[model samples]
Target chain A: MEPVTTIHGRAYPFGQKNVDTDVIIPSHWLKTITREGLGRGAFETLRADPDNLFDSVEFAGSPILVAGDNFGCGSSREHAAWALLDLGIRAVIAPSFSDIFSGNAFKNGILTVVLPQAAIDRLIEVAQSQPIHIDLDSQTVTTPFQDRFAFDIDPFRKTCLLNGLDEVGLTLAQGDAIGAFEDTVRVERPFLAVGVGS
Target chain B: MATTHPRTLYQKIWDAHVVERRDDGTCLIYIDRHLVHEVTSPQAFEALRLAGRTVRRPDLTLAVPDHNLPTTARRDAAGQRIAIADRESAQQLAALERNAPAFGIRYIGDADAEQGIVHVVGPEQGFSLPGATIVCGDSHTACHGGLGALAFGIGTSEVEHVLATQTLLLKQSKSMEVRVEGDLGPGVTAKDLVLHITGVLGAAGGTGYVIEYTGAAIRALSIEGRLTVSNMAIEHGARAGLIAPDDTTVAYVKGRPYAPKGADWDKAVAWWRSLATDPGAVYDKVVVIDAAAIVPSVTWGTSPEDVVPITGVVPAPDSFADASKRDAAAKSLAYMGLTAGQAMASVEIQNVFIGSCTNSRIEDLRAAAAVLKGRHKAPHVKWAIVVPGSGLVKAMAEAEGLDRVFVDAGFEWREPGCSACLGMNPDKVPAGERCASTSNRNFVGRQGPGARTHLVSPAMAAAAAVAGHLTDVRDMI
Candidate 1:
C-alpha cells in the first residue's frame, strides 16, 4: 500500500445511488485466482451500455469518482475496491459508503471521501467539465469554481492512510506487546493456545 | 456517590479480545475463529505466499467450499461427493485444498461430513462458541453472533492479515439493544420477526452498531431460530447482532466435535453463563418491538428493508417522507415488477428457492417439509428446490425422510450449498422471472440478471410453490 494524501483528476461524475458491489464488480469476475486485470470487469454490466459513463472517453482514466449515497452497499468483496483501483480511480466521493467497502477501499489505497449529499451533487456537476481535487491532509474536496467541501474521517484511518500502514505493518508495530500477551495467554489459558498439549 | 458500571454483551466480548489499545481508541482484538469460503480466500492465500508468511494460528481458522458448489450432484460414480461443477469453481476449491495443508488450516470440502455453508457449519461444529470473536471474509459472518460470539465480516485484506496474525485492529462499535417481548403468534417465526424489524429499521439502520437481541420473545426462541435472527443482522445495516448465551445456547454447543469435554465444558459453560448483559446496562440505542405485532413477513422490493407483512400491500413511493427514499421506492417497485398499492399476496412466482445461511438449517427444512407434506406443487410452478445449509443438515433431513416429502411435493431435494442465494452456482432464477426465496438480499439481479426475488420464510416459499404464487404459510398450516 502507498500513502494517499491527494487525488486530483476528472471524476466519472455518475451520481448513481445504492450502487452495490455486484454492479461494481459482478460475482462472475470474482472467480479469478488473482486480483490483477480486474479493470476489464469493473462496471461490466454498466459498461455494456453504449452510452455508459465508465466507457466514455470523457471520464476514461479518471482518478476520482463522484457517486451518490450508500455506494458499495452489498457484498464484502474486496474486488469492488480492486476493480476501482485497476480502473485508475484513486478516490470516491459519496454521501455515505458501506462500512465494509469503505474499509476495503482504504486498505487498497483508495480514498473514500464522505461529503454531504449537496456537496456530492455539486462535485458531480463540476466534474462534468472540470477536475475534482481531494486533499486528505486538509480533509477537503475542492472544485475550480471556488467550491470547497470539508469532510471528517476517523483520525486513526487518516493516520494509517498517511503512513501507508497495512494491518501487517500495524500489528508488527506492537511486536513486543503482542509477544508478551501471547506468553501470558499460554500460561493462563493453555487450552486456547494453538497446538499446545496436542 | 458510588459509580455504577454497566457493560453490554458486546463490551464484554470486546474487552476480552483486546490485546493492546492504540492511541486512536482502536485495539488489537484476538480472533478465536476465522471462517473462509471459496470466493474470498484465494487472493488472501496468494498474498501470504508472495510475502513468504505462514498463518499465525492455523488451529483457529477453518475453510469450506460453498459459494460455488454444485447443488445438483450429491455424489459422483466413485462414491465421492462433487466438490464443484464448473472449471472456475473447481480452481477455487482446489486452491483451498492445496493452500489449507501448507498453512495447516482445516479444509472442509463437499466430501467432508461437516461440509455446507460456512456460516452454518461453523455453528454446527461448535466452532462458533459464546464469548468468542469470529470473523470471515463473507459479510454473513455476523450469523455466528447468535451463539453469543462477537462476529463480523472483513475484507480480503483483513483476511490475509488474520492469516498472518490472529488479530484484527479495530475500534469497538457502539451497542444497540432490540427487545422483543410477548410470545409469537401461530405461524410467526424468527424470519418473520427479523423481516418485520428490518422493515421498521430500514436496510442501513444497524450500520456502525453491534445490536443485542434480548427480551422474552428472543429468549424463548430455539437455538436455530436465534441463529436465523442473528444471521440477518447485516441486513439491518448493523455491524453484528448478538444474543447472550443461555441454557439453550449451552445445550446446542455441548458434545459437539470442537466443544470442550468434562471439566473444561463445565468451566466454559460457567464463563458463557456470565456473558449475559448486566442489569442497568445502557446502550447507545434501544428499540422495543412487540412480538405479537409481527405477522408473516415478506420482502417486496430490491432491498431487505423493502418488506411487508404477508397481508400488507405494496407501499406507494409518495408515502415516504424523504424525497430520495421516495424515488428509490419507485425504482424498486419498477424493478420488482410490482405496482404501488398492490397486494403482495397477489404476486405470482415462477421459482421458489429455500436455502442460504439465513434459512437452510434443519429446522427450516422441517418447517418447509411440514408445509409441503401431503401436498403437491402447483402445475404452473416451473421450479422449486430445497438446499440444506450443510452436509450434516442434509443428512439429518434425509434421515427424517424430509427429502422424500419434498420430492413428492414437486420440490427438488438438492445437495447442500449456497445455491441461488447469490447466483454463484448453477441454480438460479431465470431472468425476468419472479421467485419467492428464503435467501437474504432481494437485490436486483441477485439471483440472476433481471431476476426479481420476493424474500420469504421457508414455509412461505413452500406455500408459494404449492400455490404458484405468493401465499401466506398460515393458510397452508
Candidate 2:
C-alpha cells in the first residue's frame, strides 16, 4: 500500500446513485487470481458507451470520482476498490457509502469522503471543468473556485491511510494479546476451541 | 447493589469476543469461525504466501470452492473428474485446493457431499454456533446469524488480516431491532417478509447498524426460513443480521458433524439458552412491521429495494416524490424493459432460477417442489432449473423424490453450487431475457450481462415458471 496524503486531479463527475459492485467490476472479471489489470473491467457496463465519463479524454487519468449517495451498495468484493485503484482513482466523494465498501476502500488506501448532497452537487459542477483537491490531514475537499467542504473519517483509518500502514503487520505485533485471549477461551468457552490441533 | 448491565444480544457477543479495546473505540475482536470461498480468497492467500505468514488458527478456518465451480455434473459416467471449461475459474478453484492444504485449513472438495455455499455449509456443520463471531469474504455471510452468531462479510484485505491474526479491528455497530408482529398469511414466506422489509428499510437504511429480527412472526419461522431473512441483511446495507436462538435453532444444530457431543452439547445448550437479548434492553433503532400485510413480493427493478406486492402494478417513476428515486426508477424501467402501470402478473418472463444462498435449502426446495408437483412449466417459459444449496440438500431433495417432481414439471434438477445466482459458473440467463429468480439481488447483469432478474421466493418462482409471468403464489396455493 502506498501512502495517501493529498490528491489533486480532474474528477469523473459521475453522480449515479446506488452504484453497486456488480457495476464496478462484474462477477466475470473476478475470476482472476491476481489483482492487476482490473482497470480494463472497472465500470465495464457503463464504459460500454464510447463517450462514457471513464473513457473520455478529459477524465481519462482522473484521480478522483464524484458519485451519488449509497455508492458501492452491494457485494463485499474488494475488487471494486481494486478496480478503482487500477483506474487511478485515489479518492471518492459521495454523499454516503455502503459500510463494507467504505472499509474496503480504506484498506486499499483509497479515500472515501462523505459530504452533504449540496456539497456534492457543487463538486460535480466544478469537476466538469476544474480539478478537485482532497487533503487527508485536513479532511477537506477543495475546488479552485474557492469551494471547500469538510468531511469526517475514523481517526484510526485516517492515520492508516496517511502512513500507508500494513494492517496485517500491525495486528501481528499484537500476537501476544491474541494468544492470551485464546488461552482464556479454552477454559471459559471450551466449545469454541474444540477439535483444535488434532 | 451491583446493577446488571442489560445488554442486547449483539453487545453480549461483542463483549465476549473482545481480545482488546483501543482508545479510538476500535476493538480487536476475536473471530470464532472463518469461512473461505474460491473467488474472493485467491488474492488473500497470495498475500499470505508473500508475507510468509501461515494461518494463525487453521482449525478455526474452513474453505470451500463454490463460486467458480460448475453446477454441471462433476463426474462422468465412469466417475472421473469433469474438467471445468473456463480456464480462469478452474485456476481459481485450483488455487483454493492448493492453499487450503498448504495452510492446514479444512477444505471441502468439489465432489464432497458436504461441499456447498459457505454460508449454507457453516450452519449445516454446526461450525456457526450461537454467540460465535463468524466472518467470510462473501457478503451473504450474515446467513449464519440465523443461528444467533455475530457474522458479517469482510473484504480480501480483512480476509488476509484474519488469516494472519484470528481477530478483526472494528468499531461496534449501533443495534436496530426489526420486530414483525401478527401472522404471515398463506403463501407468504420468510422470503416475502424479508423482501417487504428491504423495501421498507430501503437499500441503505441499515447502513451502520446490525439488525436483530424479533417478534412472533419471526419466531414462527423455521430455521431455514430464519436463514432466508438474515441472508438479505446485506442487501439492505447492514453488515450483519441476527435472530436469537430458540428450540428450533437448537434442534437444527444438534448432532451435526461439527456440533458438540454429550457433556459439551449440554453445556453449549445452556450457554445458547442465555444468548437471547435481555428483556427491556434498548436498541438504537426499532422498525415494526405488520406481518399480515405482507404479500407475495417481487422486485420490479435492479435494486433490492425496488420491490412490490405480486398483485401490484408496475410503479411509474413519477410516483416517487424524491427526484433521485424517480430518476433511478426510470433507469430501472428502461434497463428491465418494463412499462409503467403494467400489471406485475402480466410481466412475462422466459426463465426461472430456484437457487442461491438465500433460498436453496431443503425447505426452499420442498416449497418449490410442492408448487411444481403436478404441473408443467408454461410453454413460453423456455428454461427453468432448481439448484440445491448443497450436495446434502440435493440428496435430501432426491430422497423425497423432489427431483422427479421438478423434472416432471419440465425444470432441470441441477447439482448445487450457487448455480445461476451470480452466473459465475456455466449457468446463466440469456441477455435481454427476463428471469423470475429466487436469488437475493436483481442487480444489472448479476445473472448475466443484460439479463433482467425479478427476485421472488422459490414457490413464487415455481409459480412464475408455470404461468410464464410473475404471478401470485397465493393463487397457485
Candidate 3:
C-alpha cells in the first residue's frame, strides 16, 4: 500500500450512475488468480464502443474518476477496485458509493470522494477539459475553473490511508492484545478452537 | 440504579464481536467463521503469500468451490476430474483446491457430499451458529444471519485480513427493524415477502443499516424460509439481515454434523437463546409491512424495487416523480425489452432457473416440486432447470423424489453449485433471452450479457415454466 495525500491529474468524466461491480469488471475477468493487468478487462463492455469515455485519448492515464450516485452498487468483488487501480485510477468522485466498494477501494489505496450532485456536475465538466486536484489533507476537490468542493471521510480511514497502514499492518500493531485474547479463549472456550483443520 | 440499554439483536452481536474499539470509532471485531468460495479466495491467498502470513485460525475457516463447478457432470478422457468448460473457472477452482490444504483449511470441492454454495453449506453443515460473527466473500453470506448470527460479506482485502488475523476493522452500522405483521396468505412465500420488502424499500433503502426482521409473520416462517428472506437482504442495499433464534432455529441446528454434542450442545443452545433482541429495544428506523398485503411478486425493471404483483403490469417510467428513477426505469425497460402497461403474465420467458442461494434449499425445492408434479413445462420454455443448494440438498431432495417430480415435469434436475444463479457456469440464459429466475438480483445482464432476468419465487418460476410466461403461482395452486 502507498500513502496518498494529494492526487492531481486528469480524470475520466464518465458520470454513469448505479455502476455496479459486474460492469466494472465482469465475472469472466474474475477467474484469474492474480490481480495484475486487469485494466484491459476494466469497462470492457463500455470500451467496446469506439466513443466510450474510458478509451478516449483525452482521459488516457487519468488518475481520477468522476462517476454518478450509488457507484459500485453490486457484488463484493474487490476486482472492481483492482480494475480501477490497474486502469490508473487513484481516486473516484461520486455522490455516494456502495459501502463494500468504498471499503475495498480504501484498503487498496484508492480515494473515494463523496460530494453533492452539483459539485459532481461541475467536476465532470471540468474533468472533460482539464485536470482535477484532490487534497486529502484539506478534504477538498478543486479544479482550475475555481470550483471547490469539500467532503467528509472517517477519521480512522483517513489516518490509515495517510500512513499507508493496510489491515495486516494495523492488526500486527495490536499483536500483544490479540495474543492475550487467544490465550484466554484457549482456556475459557477450548471447544471453539477445536474442530479446526481437516 | 444503573440502567442497561435494551439492545437489538444486531447490537448484541456487534457488541459481542468487538475485540477493541478505537477512539476514531473503528473497531477490530473477531470473526468466528470465515467462508470462502472459488471466485474470491485466490487473490486473498496470493496476498497472504506475499505478506508471508499463514492463516491465524484455519480451524475457523471453511473453503468450498461452488461458483465454478459444473452443475452437470462433464467428462474428459480419464474422467478423474470433472471437466470445467471455462478455462478461467477451472483454474480458479484448481487454485482453491491447492491452496486450501496448504493453509490447513477445510476444503469441500467437486461433487463432494458436503460441497455446495458457500452460503448453503455453511448452515447445512452447522458451521453457521447463533451468536457468532461470520464473514464471507460473497454477499449472500447474510443467509446465515437467519440463525441469529452477525454475518455479512467482505472483499478480497478483508478476506486476507481475516485469514491473517481472524478479525476485521469496521464501523458499526445503524440498525433497522423490518416488522412483518400478520400471517402471509396462502400462496405467499418468503421469496414474495422479500420481493415485497424490496419494493417497499427500493434498492438503496437499507443503506448504512443492518436490518433485523421481526413480527408474527417472520416468526411463523420455517427456518429455511427465514434463510431465504435474509439471503436477499443484500438486494435492498443492506450488508446484513438477521432473525433471532427461537425454538424453530434450535430444532434446525441440533444434531447437525458440526453442531456441538452432549454438554456442549446444551451450553450452545442456552447461549443462542439469550441472543434474542431484548424487548423494548429501539431501532434507528422501523418499517411495518402487512404480510396479508403481499402477493406473489416479480421484478419488472433492473432494480429489485421495480416490482409488482404477478397480476400487475409494467409501470411507465414517467410514473416516477424522481427524475433519476424515471431515467433508470426507462433505461431498464429498454434493456429488458418490456413495454409499459403490458401485463406481466403476458410476457413470455424462454428460460426458467429455480436455483440460487436465495431459493435452492430443501423447502424451496419442495415448494416448486408441489407445483410441478402432474404437470409439464410449456413447449415454448426452452430450458427449465432445478439445481439444489448443496450436494446434501440434492441427495435429500432425491430421497424425497423432488428431483423426479421436476424431471417428469420437463425441468432439468441438475446438481448443486450456484448453477444459473449468476450464469458463470455452463448454465446461462443466452443474450437477448428473458428468464424467470428465483435468484435475488434483477440487475441488467445479471444472468448474462443482454439477458433479462425476472426475479420470482421458486413456485412462481415453476408456474412460469408451465404457462410459458410469467404466471401467478396462486392460480396454479
Note the Cα lDDT for every prediction shown: 0.87, 0.91, 0.88
Candidate 3 chain A has its poorest 10 consecutive residues by lDDT at A188-197
Which is the better candidate, 1 or 3, if ranked by lDDT? 3
What are the interface RMSDs of all the models?
2.9, 2.0, 2.2
Q: Candidates' TM-scores?
A: 0.83, 0.83, 0.83
lDDT, residue B402, model 1? 96
- Model 3, span B133-156: residue lDDT tens: 899998899889888888999877
Number of the top candidate by TM-score? 3
Select the stronger candidate by lDDT from 1 and 2: 2
Chain A TM-score of each model, in the order shown? Answer: 0.90, 0.88, 0.90
lDDT of 1 by residue, A16-117 (tens): 999999999997787897776799999999999989998897888999998998999998888999899889998998999999899888878788889888
DockQ of 1: 0.29
Q: Docking quality tier of candidate 1? A: acceptable
Which regions of candidate 2 are displaced past 4 Å? A1-29, A36-165, A195-197, B1-3
RMSD for each of the candidates: 5.9, 6.3, 5.7
Q: Considering DockQ, where higher is better, how would the candidates rank from best to worst?
A: 2, 3, 1
User: Can you give the DockQ of every candidate in the order shown?
Assistant: 0.29, 0.38, 0.36
